[model samples]
Target: MRTADSAAEFQTAAQWQSWLSQGSTFPVFQPVLSLETQTVFGYECFGRLDLSENVASLGTFFRASDQTLNTLQQEVGFTLAQQVAQFFSPVKDARLIVNELPSHLTALTPLELPSTLEALQQAKFPLNRVVLDVLLEPGFQNPLRLKTVMERCHSLGCQVALGNLGSENSQLDLIPYLKPDFIKISLTLFHRSFRDRQFRRTLEQLGRLAENSGSALLIEGIETAEELQQALQLGARYVQGYYFSAPGRLPAPLPDFQKKLREALENFRMIRTKRIQRQVTWENEMLLRLVDISFVLFEADGLLRLNETDLEGLSGFIHRLYFSDLNGFQISGDYLLSETGCQIDYRDVGRNLSLRPYFFDHVYKLHGRPGGWSLSDVYCDENSRCLMRTFSRYVTPQAILYLDVLWANFADL
Candidate 1:
């Protein structure tokens, strides 16, 4: 097959047209696996041309002017649709995902659905088993046009997928508007973004968005065991890459694919469970130490108001310290620690915290029990812009001492 490097040899539009007209392209299927089921969920059809090594890929031939590209896309689309029908007709469960450029679909004047539908019908391929995978490019600037194209595909009873998500050209903000059945996240972007601390939060947001938008998150280009594990941890429903199998001329069941996937999943889950267990155990130990220190302070000066000096001793571990009554009303001022020193904020002294979850739900359970302390899960502190875990314990008969510890410090412990 010709590689992309031979593009200079076919500079003329006629030569490119002639090449595509010969119908010399064949579809290679790449398996898209389900992490949960550890099975092949679908196959993405890559159109490969029987050309020299210089051409590299089919995409090189279609990079001419807009008109030429559009013409080439239509010809290639028709050929691919027919090829898919021929190759995947017997496959009842797995879907055949065919690539379609958004520009080609939007540019079709009278629409070219009839010819494709007729071709699939003649080849005995089911429309429901077909997925129209649209590549999001910068040229696709009009949302309405894209929506029209999506509607046309759905009207033909085929599922729609938006590919190249998170790529440079991908319109990430338009995902909600497109509402595709699958959002194919680029592996390059996924890896680059994963290095950031905020990546997990962003991934979680995307996962929720996909769930709410009724779209499945498909992480493409998963080439290693680590990548597969990370994708699974981030809640990817569909995964594709060389980790399973590279693109091939024929589609078949992978050798021991299910077993390998299940084992990897089991290992990932076990590691994740152990990590969480360690975190919980460490947090419990820190909370116990804090509780002991609080009891010592309480016994030293029975029910006395805690000032900046008293909180300074524990400032290295605690972020905020305050005392609340049995009804969850703040009696003492908030003593907060900063880089400079501990400071007392007297304004928060008469505020009621009874409605807060840590006080009303968590601490209330341990109200009457002696030597009992309630430790909260790690939560974001709005004031400090840091993760905090609140540890509440009954210091006196009428008061409860609340210690807000920075999770970062606790993690170090």
Candidate 2:
């Protein structure tokens, strides 16, 4: 996987200009899909050359051209804007997202969006059906230019999207202010999020941010079925990749491509629903067990009168049992039963649990009301290094009961 950063100038500016002038190269489109509607949202434009039964990527060529052909958009992009006008219908056709050319991404020059829109207008392409994709490079320093470009797009009835997101060097801070209609993330980040916890957190936050900020999330480079599933899980409404349709000189592949998306969407929903059901059932089962244990604690009079010997009954199901007062200070010894049968530890009695989410969140949510069990987010248990969640409830007005359970014990079911 060679990156554009390391891309060497394979052709001079003069050579690319000569090749493009022959009018042999034209626009190719890869579709962007809306998973929710299960329909094609739009097509993303790329430059394509008809090479006698073989085709190569011209858009990628200019982007990875680095030092050379940086001005390709000035010539070739404008040419295809005219050609593209003829290919798509104004109403029936889905929108097209054009990548702002590599040269136009500079801080030194004015944004090319105004020029691109002017080209689209000159070509008679429908302004309402165009989406401009702006890539924010690692350290894109020109916010004013980008904001101005995006404003122009909206005013012209064209949408704007921030592209090439989720890469390590992608400029994320800009997404908030620009508030483009869409944010496009590469498939590379989808794969990384599965293995890396911190990356997964970032991905989750990105999803939330998109939802809150009214930007649709689009995942690109989905080459496989598995990648498509992950993108759906990431809550990406718009997706682009070879899985649904490949890039080609287009009249658009609507009939066949729509059929493919229909099947993919059907399969995704069935699988996703079953996964949700399984988790829901596990949660219900856990909640039932917690309730049963709560009954037992009440029988022991909120654990105040319960001795070490009294803790023996809850052996297998309950890992540890203790209580904290209204002020979040531990008030009761841990009561547990196991092969060791009946153990109580007061060493942590005065420990403060105030700052922990299991404490504060429970306090805040149930503050006025004070009844109801709450579960904490999963974390690794120091001793076992296994995933753990704290289950908490108010057993008495003064005492909040805490139970530690082996999360996998209930989860494996």
Candidate 3:
């Protein structure tokens, strides 16, 4: 588990350049998967080479390379690009995403690309199939030069990508202005409140921009199946990283593994759906009970009073309705003191109440609306906990006659 810093300790710029000149780098290809097809669409280029006591260490070598490393980086990138072009031949419609250091543009001109294109063409490679991913490390400062390079590559029919994009870095959004053919979102953003609805909305806005400008979205560093599912659900057209396939010189023979992953994802979906369905069934069942209880309470003479002990006894029933043993519930209305209750705080009923956020919301808003018996779908509380419940009230068009409760306190019933 050595990091970029740990890798840096073993190599220096001069040694890195020497390795590049000697063609000592080993190339690995990581598969990119299509969101819709769930199949391998292409491969992203990665480099690994043996360094001082470190076997096949990309992190260390790249970390150690400094300004002196620029010469070697350009040379290595061009040579690897050439190798990738050759490798992709005979795999019709398959693409290769070669990593490019921004500094390499100094050595590469519009004219030299023709020879690279010619080599690929000779190998029966499609010119449009090559995508050059411009890696945006902290040292990549020359945006104007990067723009020029991107324009030159695009004019030649090759696509350019904004690799490792970030919101904190002002330079990252420059891709939209330059109009790269694709934008590869950095993995860091995945952990940055991506599960939040606001973040998803922001992502949707970005996706819309990319769509309008004809730029494709490629999400990277999808290490887990859950992450891949979220990215695909969020409209990422392309995805890549260890979750799909690790980098290698050749495509990994993983048809069975791919099928297993697919089935696992499908199972995840089925489990979620069934869990929701179960909650709905419980809510419906509780609603029927609430309706029955409301009828009994409505026919009572006065306040129809019930106490904390009554609430406690109904805690089991509440547990069934809310599916949470931690909750307690109470219902209070004028001329209706029947508490099918637990020790739940009345002040907290609809606000600080432990029920799902949407459930609380529905109850608080239900006051003005006509209410017989109704249930809410599962939703995250403000604390991001899921809850389900049903509430029913016996009332006339002019006044509420009785209130009945079914919540987490009775969810398990």
lDDT of 1 by residue, 185-242 (tens): 7666689756864566567677778888899999988888888888877779888888
The best candidate by lDDT is 1
Per-model TM values vs. the true structure = 0.75, 0.77, 0.56
Off by over 4 Å in 1: 1-15, 18-23, 52-55, 60-65, 109-118, 289-306, 320-413
Candidate closer to the true structure by TM-score (higher is better), 1 or 3:
1
**Candidate 2 Cα deviation (angstroms), residue 107:** 3.9
Q: Which runs of model 3 end up more than 4 angstroms from their true locations? A: 1-7, 10-12, 17-23, 51-54, 59-65, 106-125, 139-141, 167-172, 194-205, 257-413
Rank by lDDT, highest first.
Answer: 1, 2, 3
- Candidate achieving the largest TM-score: 2
Clashes of each: 12, 0, 23
Residue 119 CA error for candidate 3 (Å)?
7.1
lDDT of 1: 0.73
Which RMSD does model 1 reach against the true structure? 5.7
lDDT of 2 by residue, 379-409 (tens): 6665556666787878787788888777767
Give the C-alpha lDDT of model 3. 0.56
